[model samples]
Target: MKEGNGLQIPAGMRDLLPGVACDQRQLESRCTGLFTSWGYQEVITPTLEYLDAITIDTGEEIRDHLFQLFDRQGKILALRPEMTTPIARVVATRLRGAALPLRLCYAANVFRYEEPQAGRQREIAQAGVEMIGAATPLADAEVIALAVEAIKQSGLEDFQISLGQIEIFNGLMEELPLTVEQKSKVRTLVAKKDFVSLEELLNSYGITGAPADRILQLPTLHGGAEVLEQAAWLGVNDRARQGLENLRQVYQALASFGVSDFVALDLGVLRGFDYYTGIVFEGYTVGLGFPICGGGRYDNLLGQLGYPCPATGFALGLDRILLALARTNPPARATSAVYLIGGDDTAAMLNKATQLRSQGLSVEIDVLGRDEASLQAYAQTRGITQVQYCRQGG
Candidate 1:
């Protein structure tokens, strides 16, 4: 890249100008408001942390995406590629003894070093909530319900939260007659949804009958509630069945909580983070090709940080959400009612402006030296609600 590129920022980063910034804040506010109402307080973690601390539970894929550097003292450091890890660190160290079932939320920017593409950014804005110390299906249901409500509140329609349980997969892998390496390979293939490759893999392993059939069946087992029933009878093992039952309870509870219409069961829904020991899910809409929101149960994450507690949470990407909203219901330009008065009438304008501001109205004194007719035209063009002439000496 040339130095003459006119104040160029690195690739995968862009500025959020006025209009989009307004929408971004509105989106963040709505999410944080919903979190606050649910008693989840917000936390802001630093953008940089000791590299090892950030990479504790996140897998190699996530670590590879981190932008790493060395500090003056030669200690390795990284810009946080995701927000949850930072939050988990704090919960384990700082808020460990604060309380049981800590409810926390944050709207913050995260950085990554990855090839930029649609719905992806090097610097992304995220609004998320994490509930710590709660370990039950209801806690899972709470986060999922909040997620649905958040999308609904954002004015997004036709989005679905595909819920899956890592325990089901874990249980099945434990029962499979495959090598340790083979099990990891199966997980990778299934997560990618590469059925052909998965089939080839199973065939190569000399696996047949129900084990092979069930493995292939997973990536496509998404639909109405019946899928849960089908999962319950997959015959994998006691552990898998127990996990499926737990998932079923959470799904049904979400229905009773009134957000079922926006959720579906998908056995193949695997989140990349290995810390997720139980249910996981991602939110998707019609037009956008990526999940706008995602999260799951990470019962072991805090323990790795020396804060042993069960937790669940999810994060919505503000930029992708804005894109989804734009594709679906493109927001109208944000507007406020304002009356612009002409000329320099500081005393009177100040008094009037003060009164209008006090009343929660937008008022502006003409600083452009625009004449009465020109001022009226300017106000009209700018959608100023009213226009008046404030003679200079009056």
Candidate 2:
């Protein structure tokens, strides 16, 4: 690649200009406020963490995405790829003896070294909560319901949360007679929704009939409560049955939370993270191809971090939420009026500007000493409404 003038940001990174940045903050504020109202207190963690600690339970796929650097002592430090691991680290070390069921929340930027796309970026902003120490279905339901509510509160009316349980797939895979590599391949195929490749591969391994059919039908199992009944016969093993039962319990709880209408049963849903032990889900809007939010019950993460505790949580992609809102509802033009004060008397203009600012108004003063016509033109160019002409005596 030819080196040009050094005016370019690295690939997979882009600047959020004034207008877009403001919208992003507003969206994040709405979601974080909602989390606080639900008794979840906010926590902040370092953007860089010990590389070994962060990837302790995240698996090789996530490990490959980390942005790594060496510290002064040659210790490897990495920009956090996700908040869950760091939060888990904190819970195990700092808040270990705080109490059971610690409700924590965070809104922070994480970095990942990956090929960026529409919704995916190298630097991602996430707002999420982790519910530590509760293993009940209600805890799982709380996070899901909160997720639905968070997205709704972000001005996104058209969205759905597809709920799934990792145990369901794990059980089914265990019942099958495939090797570890074969099972991994199946998981990848199912996650990609590549039924054709999955079937071809399964058949190539000489697996067919009911066994193959069940695996193929797994992804198709999606809908209302009735989908659970349809899956009854499929959960021939104890583990699979337990996962289905857990989903049923969580589903009922979601109804009580008044968010069942926004959720659907998607048995094929799979989370990429390896720590998720139970129910998992992803939130999707109408037009966007990627999920605006995702998370699940990682009952084992804290345990792996040396604290044996059950936990459930989620993270919403702030950038993707902004994208979804832009598609559905472009915000009404800045209704919060901005004023530009200009006049013969600098003191009067400054005083007026200060007064307006005190009242929570956005005010700008004409420091250039321009004429009324030029001041008005400047305001018009800058989209500053409500231009005022203050005078020494008027």
Candidate 3:
């Protein structure tokens, strides 16, 4: 290969060097332990999927973020932009006959075509779990509680889980005879926290007084348990009323689990993902610009994949979480690894390296023709703390 001028990696893509990779592995291992303790089984899915297989109404937002290519059969394929859709496909097809209340976990790298920013990237790693076949309020509470515990176990203490019910907006839309276009506009406004636009849209429809007040209050309906009571006092229509009741039930269940301290209700939290059908929530760190973790109930998603099982899951942005933790605590010193240097004693060095690995130590042997000083420099640069010199018949 010939070197070219200004040849460089793409903007949003990044390479994780040895030290950073180790840090990521540690974080992932810790998360896996937490999920396993909660009785979730691990599952692996493919990185590529036929565009049609993962398609959904809310998929338009995701499509713009996907890295798409043409397959050998002239079919469009996309690098997975998220794990939930693929997991839903798996549940709908492969595990369609699995037992009820199936719990699954996964760790994967997802690709997205988006501009990179601090703590954001085109390729990101995530660790997540899905709880399927359980639709009770207690089930929802259990997942949220588990999420809180996972964050705590990840060494992140200053974080909050913002909860929202998609039903609130869905309920309000059900009462008004609005076109799909209007509903979409409302959804967009709500997601962007555009209160002025929301007010204009509501007022333009001839809604005023109590009805208008309640509609505008949608964006601000967030806080603690008190927010739920205020939401109820706003004269919820039949659909909104039902949604509110469901939310109250979820909150009470969470309280019973002793995890209400880390939760807050946010009625205006309309995540950009369209697949979310019910209660939606995201975990946020104060210093980060985006959620470190997100997931929600998608009871209808599996149905789209041919299975009708209800499911809810959450995914932690492993890379972003690591970046945030790095900013706060700095990455711990890389563990010392053993480096074996040899020449004519290559066989001996290799044997010793294998033995060290068997004992659970990272061991690397020099196979190149570099001299001892060069080998020592290489080991030092890689944060290798020990170097063992191996000579034949000595």
Candidate 4:
């Protein structure tokens, strides 16, 4: 007796039942506490925005990934694919006059139209922080430290923060004599980790020298601090050379914060987002394939929005972090419920349930007129370890 479509949820989306929902809420609460303690205030942005607002040069690859629709007013809108652009718009327009180094945090669901995978979903929850109006290296360092601490607070023990400088690639691009079409091809190859294609492309352009070799090495260049020294020998142009120096200064600033142990340098980490102007980083756990969190400095993005402020922040994928932590440390079992049975004592059960709820206890009553045996079976299936009996006399 079902409808035409049958009862089923859509693909790349899911319902979080009681057990998973409870665990997720606990994780969100823990993260909220951590953010509040760090003096970052929480803010909420609309889940949907004008399509053009969220899609500006977000990258050609991601444009098709957004879930778009037409509003009642005949305007194109999209469920936000990411939080950064909306937050940037907020800072640019509404909070433009707020103090420097504004720290704002949020936990919300973001939508994307994409093929579903084991742990990735089209609709996902993200908890992130944005610090606007600060362009100092110390601001970047603080964001990195905060990301590490949030992961640690989530019960993750083994993890690494891979750091990179966008300027590295920008520097190389500035020095390249290739045409725009060739530059696009190089960016695509670099992003895909297609070193063979990169070498082929370089050879096709008839470019040969230490600079080409160094640029070719970009994809494989990542490790500890010493890799920075090796990068220096790559024979970059003066602009690229200055960019390298900027990276060195940022790395030293991170070291001064005492978070050097958790950081790794990766000169090849040209994050996919086209907006990032400088430092970029992603957090990874050993068992996970994708980064649990990522962010970067976008000094020019605000200017695009008309305010022209420098900002940097990171977004923690709440669902992915929950999954990673669940693998490492499974969430504790939910508490037992107090079940009230029998329709005869409905009034008494209602009063008792309300009282228990006030006392911060999970309480349920049988309204289906089932027998005690059936009610017991239901409780067992729900993982209610204990049940309290309430009677009219008692």
Quantify all predictions' global Cα lDDT against the true fold: 0.87, 0.89, 0.83, 0.82
Candidates by TM-score, descending order: 2, 1, 4, 3
- Please give each candidate's TM-score: 0.94, 0.96, 0.89, 0.90
Q: Give candidate 2 regions above 4 Å deviation.
A: 1-5, 333-337
Top lDDT model = 2
**Model 2, span 3-78: residue lDDT tens:** 8947788877889987888888888899889999999999999999999899987877888888899988999999
Q: How many clashes (backbone N, Cα, C below 3 Å) per candidate?
A: 0, 0, 0, 0
* lDDT (Cα, tens digit) per residue for candidate 3, span 93-144: 8888999999999999999888889878999999989999999888888888
- TM for candidate 3 is 0.89
Best by TM-score: 2
lDDT of 4 by residue, 228-255 (tens): 8878865366666776777777789888
- Ranked by TM-score, the better of candidates 1 and 3 is 1
Higher-TM-score candidate of 1 and 4: 1
> How well does candidate 2 match the true structure in TM-score terms?
0.96
Clashes of 3: 0
Q: Candidates 2 and 3: which is better by TM-score?
A: 2
Q: Residue 145 lDDT in model 3?
A: 86
